[model samples]
Target chain A: MMRTPFEVPMDGLPDRVTIYEVGPRDGLQNESAIVPAGVKAEFLARLAEAGLTTIEATSFVHPKWVPQLADAEELLTRMERVPGVRYPVLVPNERGLDRALDHGVTDIAIFGSATETFARRNLNRSVDGSIEMFTPVVARALENGLDVRAYLSMCFGDPWEGPVPVEQVVRHGRRLLDLGCSQLSLGDTIGVGTPGHVTALLAAFAEAGVGPERLAVHFHDTYGQALANTLSALRAGVTVVDASTGGIGGCPFAKSATGNLATEDLVWMLSGLGVETGVDLESLVATSVWLAGELGRPSPSRVVQALAAESPGRRNVTQVPAEVPPAVEEE
Target chain B: MMRTPFEVPMDGLPDRVTIYEVGPRDGLQNESAIVPAGVKAEFLARLAEAGLTTIEATSFVHPKWVPQLADAEELLTRMERVPGVRYPVLVPNERGLDRALDHGVTDIAIFGSATETFARRNLNRSVDGSIEMFTPVVARALENGLDVRAYLSMCFGDPWEGPVPVEQVVRHGRRLLDLGCSQLSLGDTIGVGTPGHVTALLAAFAEAGVGPERLAVHFHDTYGQALANTLSALRAGVTVVDASTGGIGGCPFAKSATGNLATEDLVWMLSGLGVETGVDLESLVATSVWLAGELGRPSPSRVVQALAAESPGRRNVTQVPAEVPPAVEEE
Candidate 1:
């Protein structure tokens, strides 16, 4: 029997997608090798050149806790700031916020996982305990005129508990949003989430008044469902997506985590759908390729290599072969 | 406010999802080191032992074209011949068929791309031209009492021809199925596909008279949508899914292409959902880890390392930590 090609119905999609680059913090945190601050700054500069409006530059968490970002202050101090790019660093408490404010981080992301176990394990405190620790930080950041974005990790699934409870995700999201988070990004930490799971979770969040306008969907490409799940979220009206250039980072806590969905891959999907993301696919690829060499292996972003390979010597935005049915087998 | 845990309506899922393991052919093809015939045979043997009833063992395409499978005949001859396991080899032409039959392969997969540019660049023919070529090959194999599976590449998107039209894909799928293909697998060659694309294509295929039972969904994780797309297809009643273990393969025709969906990742999703695939997750991880060592890189399947790392010395299936979210970046 003959099957016709799929017709994508883009009836309601966000006009412009905000790509929050998390390469510096989320990306480097999971890597076992300690990247030098100079190299990390170089990487951040390249990402900014790729037209990323917001990059999760660094985390102000205790250096002893996250050894990867021990040079956080130095990295922030040395970066060649992109004029319009908002570099949001994660600050866990008053001390962390103090560091970011001192370093002139105008926008800050105050993050917390949904589950008690993750909060306890990752932040070394229970969910409420971490939030209590965060309240003053949020108040101070807001008082200091900083824009705060709360990350609710394990929004979809947990490592200890199979599937995440929606109520928990929404509850966590509400706290962050109520605390003037401006935006709440729901994360599927382990990448075990499916579209249905995403739909249900987000719908629940919406029902409780967390509309898509103030929501961003952060996904891991663990199960190869990141894009599909992202598509579902897009149709459901998510405007902001957190991604990494060259898909650099992972969740240090998740055992088999891959990097965030490659920004190149995300931009490719968005640009292909005619959805506006303000990201140049070609520059993103060039940036990823450069990072790949620095990382000493091929990048996790399959699109970067495929597009670069196909258009050898051609400019970045050459006629893209439509719809390369994703063949990547990354777990 | 505590959010309740999210859960999918698993009761309605289909029983016994089809496992189309392409590791033997697709997996080995991308390896830079040439795996000896005995090693390839050993690989296939291990695959069958993992209870994979359907394995695309080897391709009889010219050795000059794909040097990795130069020993296709020798490898097939030494397969373990596990009962109920359908070992299909790629037969591009009549000569290839003779070789596969010589090795006593009862099932064979004959593949061709949908777009003219790809057909010409990949198989050296037009869409119509390749179909004409495959007809005789399909006929010969059917006459030899062999089951035939037609592989339609670039069904959703073409590498050269941007977005492939539904009308064109349908025409190709109909022709191949008409020529006696018992099963047809639609591929997103460059891994640049979405669920809307998959759902639309599969729905069109079903509308064209092909039932879910007669089709397989082949996706790449290029955009990290392969597994999520697979789930959408499964929801639409399609069962067969082609995945590679440890994500150890890439499209020869596509550049910077990543590995296929790690079989371990696919199986983990399936197992979590209670779908009976009949493959052991721990053993799959072990095999992927061992193979990764042989290949001198980490396995693409993050599940293997995550699970292995958590347990360290034992293959444990303990549920992920309830507190921390499942590792998002790893997958």
Candidate 2:
């Protein structure tokens, strides 16, 4: 081996990152099939076993609206809570918040939209109206000594509105923070976020007195910009990221929507960057493979697919060994 | 709509970027099926029509090694070269260089490996021996007044070697630059590169007196980090990127390899960032779709898949519009 001069230094990077695994709630909610409560609980356990510190368990929503996660309460009751892991459920309004409290949920998330069109279409309210709806829920949760996270969707681009202005997203995001939500997750709901957009949004948020410490990033892989946007967010000083196992979930309304950023893919980047994520890559890959099998589909995540295909059992089926006669095999 | 304060200014970003379209050469070379010469020519023309300034036409390697691109000469002869568009071909050795010269090729690229394992497996030589083999070819091309590029493969990770040290990659890359190549394209051959690693390597390269202006980035999406790595490179001031149309091409020796960073995906990000790439995104998407049809498979690019599925003709086939009740349709 030839020795070389000069080593690459990892500079200006956060030493640790918090991955908010949303596979159980956000990922499954948009899935067509209704995963059994037991199966959902098992998936959470597997995620915890793989060393994820934060996992969104399920959502408190009307069965008539999101039939896939109607059994959220049952899953909460049946699931084993790991001692060090945090399981937050999505709560849309006061009624949902009440239901979550009834289920003994300690952490909760409230979603708001940055775009007026998405707010009206998805929540039957204008952007201001949706904030009005979330205000009471956030106040009640904060009073109950519960941690609340606010998710501001369409922070990048809106399908109907096209490219959203940054000022609008900042105003909407700050309002949610003012409502007493501890952290605000900027969401690239349609996955149209570019790295430059991410940096600009983060800068705008910073200018508004909201720093990375009080922010998280949630991205969709709709146009394959999720991971890239995540990288930009990380560089912008964000430490919290939201991702899905097996890259499941696409918006029903937006047929072009793909899954959230895959947890395996995020782990791969973090691991290579020497960032301390504390997540086991191989175990995460296995869990995604198992979930993909249950869904009766291949994982949309490139990492999961590559690792699964590399295993001995599937290797022969998918990949033929290189036919080069080993004329120069070196140890 | 509520009035808000703040604009996310695109600060410290390059105003323009150059995309090196490699679908015709690097992409097709790894494909299993040999694309017809006429179709290859058409693909090249389509890329140019989409405003790609630099297109790698084909590899001038022996037919036995890269049979998929064995029609290199035919492709060059049959294709209508767009004015102001540079079509470069990969030249493996002196013989390949002679073939390129015979065809009046103005631009040529030579590939070298950073890791010993890949060098032996892909080129049947050690890293040193591979560089030695390229010295004469690069010198000959430069002497003939042709623009030459050197592609340094596995700069980030190797299938067998795992994470290659940054020092090793910088040394190899600097040597290639010293060999009279105009540009050095750092390739993450196994797709294990993360944003942090890209920064670190670029920093190491800078320490070795190599600037981003003389560098291009080639990333694979095997682990879904290609776009993310590309973003990092762009942020690090690298203006040129290598991408494959329809996200074609996976390394043959590396079974876990996936497609190159899709040109459509790159253009989508560049456009969103307000960076000028001079490429028409819809035209690029159409070309990828057309090529996918010719290949008898769906494109691996998320942008191509999303845009194609969103069109009116394919809308009813892959996606069923949401059946949400009008009670919530406030928009």
Candidate 3:
């Protein structure tokens, strides 16, 4: 029997990668129907059970802005905190950070856009103004003994600004890191990025002394280049990848944006590359299938769709509820 | 105004690539409805006009097997052969090659599988048996002064054989190449490939004295790794990429297999990377959208979907057919 079918790594590839699962928060943020708080908690728990160490649970953005994740505090409170797993929530401002801290959140993320047009349209501030706003929010979170992650959106292309310069993105990313954010996730919100753009951006970041350890890649599948761009980042030594289960999430900024890189798809690639992501492929697929049912739509993920079609009864997350019923003694 | 929004190529990446369009033949072969011969010819003409130098027009396979492409000879006969464009068709055996020769076909392709299961199911023979069957087909095609391309399917994963060995695939690939094939397209029929797998396979092939110049990559987007795998192959110096317009063509052998890498999506990535493919993105998207409407379904190509959503009337292929009508004078 072949013990390792695709368990051999090629030269210059990472031995292991960290998949920062963002399905619970970013994936559902743009959803039309607000998911129940308990359901959100259950989804996060399943993701953690599938061996994902970091799962972005929910966002603390105002209900008017992101009604889908309005029950952030309630979801976090009801969630079982898996040991050794980190649940990061999106914090837009100091007020959101304070709310997250009140819920005992250890990890929080702030977002800014690399392009002025996106920052102005999405966050109601200029690019520099958005950075200034996030500066204090990140500093306060770090001071409160929480790990901060800064997401620099529109890192690749801006719907209004067109192609963003590599140097500009690196500058904003470095600023966030300097402001005490533990990690900086460069986002392709419009999904117009190619592998060459990713390679060039990562190389520029390395030249600016921002190592891969401090960088994560968050890509959208609008142009279907997410996985390819992720590969470019991986080859450039960036270990952290942000993906959505069931390939959920449309960018609130870019209306044409599709879903993020599907977690199942990402896991498939990593497993094939012999890169350890500590993710259970079967379990992850189940979670996506379950989530797809909850969302009342078919998943946009090719892996989820393919696997579901393979086994008719595979999406059994609904069959087994989040809470088990007490054994009935009937004879 | 930005002179080149996405015209910068990265270091160590291919500056140019050859996109072998496979929509008319491979793409439509799996369709349930048979496209009209005129439509097929129009599609081929539009593909050539959109700057594709090589288009797989039709397959000479028996009509009983692929009813969708049954009008292969008629489509070829009615097609206006563009200058500097090579139109190749699939020839299953000596009979098929003879039929192609009767139509004055200049280039032909023969397909075999690297795995025995796919070989038996697809060709009704073992891997060796299938290769032996194709040896004469390829030799005959070469004897007729035709360029022969051998497609080796299931090079990455087999539905029955979990993960094919890299060395074993290389051996099969070498056999096809040694059989006087001008080019060999390694197919991931099940779409279970990663960048590492692609890199490793290409490297192994190089070791076996088969360089990337003699190879083309035919990937399916089942797990959303098609573009990534193509990127890896491109980085490894394999410049020929096989893609289907509108992301058409599900493998008949693998039920779970999705469409091949969409030519529009591939062109988007290659264009963004500043890799010249000579394909006009707008015109190709229009072709996909028009064909999608003709097929009574939405296109699976992300670029086509995104661009169509952005422009309501961008799919003007219906407005102006490939053979434009002479401008009517005022009556």
lDDT (C-alpha, whole model) for all candidates: 0.72, 0.79, 0.78
Clashing pairs in 2: none
Write down the TM-score of every candidate.
Answer: 0.82, 0.91, 0.91
Interface RMSD of each: 10.3, 8.0, 18.0
Candidate with maximal DockQ:
2
By lDDT, the best candidate is 2
Tens digits of lDDT, candidate 2, B258-281: 668889888887777778889988
Per-residue C-alpha lDDT of model 2 across residues A1-331, encoded as one tens digit per residue: 1111112335666888999998888888877777789889899999999999999998876777778788988898899999999999988778788888998999999888888877877778898888888888888999998999988887876656767887899999999999998899998776767777888889989998999999999988878988878877887899999998878886554443466888988887777677788899889888988987777666788888677766633323233212121222222
Per-residue lDDT over B1-331 for candidate 1, one digit per residue giving the tens place of the 0 to 100 score: 1112233534445777978999878777766667778777777778877878898888877676577788877777676788888888888887778878777889988887777877776676677877888888899888999999988887766544667777678778888999989988988755667666666777788788878888888877655557656776777787789998877875444444565777877776676555778897767777777777776766666566555455444432343322121221110
| Alpha-carbon RMSD, each predicted model | 6.5, 4.8, 10.4
**Rounded to one decimal, what is candidate 2's iRMSD?**
8.0
The 10-residue segment with the lowest total lDDT in model 1 chain A: A322-331
Worst 10 residues of 1 chain B by lDDT: B322-331
Which scores greater on DockQ, model 2 or model 3? Answer: 2
Global local distance difference test of model 1: 0.72
Instruction: Place model 3 in a CAPRI quality band.
Output: incorrect
